[model samples]
Target: MLQAFESAAFAAWPAQQSLDLLGWHLRLDRGYTKRANSANATAQSLPLTASDVQAIENHFRRSGLTPTFRLTSFAPIEDSDRLLDACGYRACDESLVMTRSLAGFVDGSEIAFAPDAAAWLDAFAHASGKRGADQAVHLEILRRITAPCAWAVHASDGPSPACGLGVLVGDQLGLFDVATHRDHQRRGLARMLCGGLLGWGARRGAQTAFLQVVAANSPAIRLYESLGFEIAYRYWYRVPTT
Candidate 1:
């Protein structure tokens, strides 16, 4: 189930565009987010040979985007990590994929379900510190979600949206781009969004929920632990060590 969520989450949060080369997904979105611009191993059927590595590197370099690889535990290629090491790639942003069972309806007060991309985009930009084309790519990504999406904002305090998140995917309720605004750091806005989203999921027939956060983010990790989330697996980026 964790593996299923891993793959489903990737599909839920797609790039502005994508292409499959040699059975691997090459995601692109003007280099906005790693998940968008990296070379994904989720669907690869071929082995990761040195030649394939060069091809992968060349493919992204041709478009001025750094070649990146997201290696999940369930990746089709088993020796991917070793191969990347031979190719001089180093790992970073080791993240934990966590999940929990469905909870009752969380009072999702001030959590506005977006009818479209506009409201969510504004909140996303502020929460994630995106600007210019970086921000524009986010909007484009939001439009690509085909599942029953709920782009929500936690603004019970006042008119300003304090934090935001997009719950995508299906019964798994994949959470993506969850961020809190700078001014709302110590508050419990993120906690609200998670519980509320879980309730929203229950109402929509979702049985479980999942999200990924950097292992280095202790605060976020602690928060998730308090919510009954446990480590399902870990993933990280393999990039040129240079």
Candidate 2:
């Protein structure tokens, strides 16, 4: 089931495009977030021999992207971590994949679906603190998702906006781009957005809600737990030192 989400999340947030190399899904989205650009090696069938590793690096290098791999608990290739370590790849950004059932949901009035990509981008940028290629890459990725999407914002009565979030890939309703405004921290806006989005998904016939949060983020993890979400699995990125 956890493995299913790793694939579902990838499907929901696809790269600008991707390639299948030796049963591995090599996602390419310029040089944006690791989640988008890194290859998912959970399904690798080959032994990840030295030549295979070098070829993977060369491919990403030529593609103008750093070689990266997203490693999960169920990766087929054993010793992937040792191989990555020997190759000067460091593990980073360990994150938890969480899920919750949608039984008693409350429709959130403070949250609304983004009318257009521009509006969605505005709130997304504010919460995530990303722009330029970093931001543009995600906008393109979001467009690739054909599922019913809800780009939500925490509407504030005052002038200052609180935060933003996105619920793409329905039924599963994978949550991504969750962020809080830089100026607004520890204000519970994220909690509001999360509740609102989950309820919003429930109304759309979504039965399960899933999201990825950095494991190091204690506050965020605590928040999710308080909301009845439990960790399903975890993943991390292996990136080249250079």
Which candidate leads in lDDT?
2
Model 2: per-residue lDDT, tens digit, 1-242?
Answer: 66667777887777776887777778887787888787787554455767778888887888888899887866666576788889899989999999988876775547655676667887777666766765676677767777677777777664325444445554677877778877887888778788887877888887888999999999989988998899888788889888
- Separate clash counts for every candidate: 0, 0
Kindly provide the TM-score of model 1 when superposed on the true structure, using C-alpha atoms.
0.86
Against the true structure, what is each candidate's TM-score? 0.86, 0.90
Point out where model 2 deviates above 4 Å.
Answer: 107-109, 157-160, 168-170
The lDDT, on a scale of 0 to 1, for candidate 1 is 0.75
lDDT of 1 by residue, 72-168 (tens): 7666676777899888999888888998877554555446665577777776676767767666767777777778787777655453445455454
Total clashes, candidate 1? 0
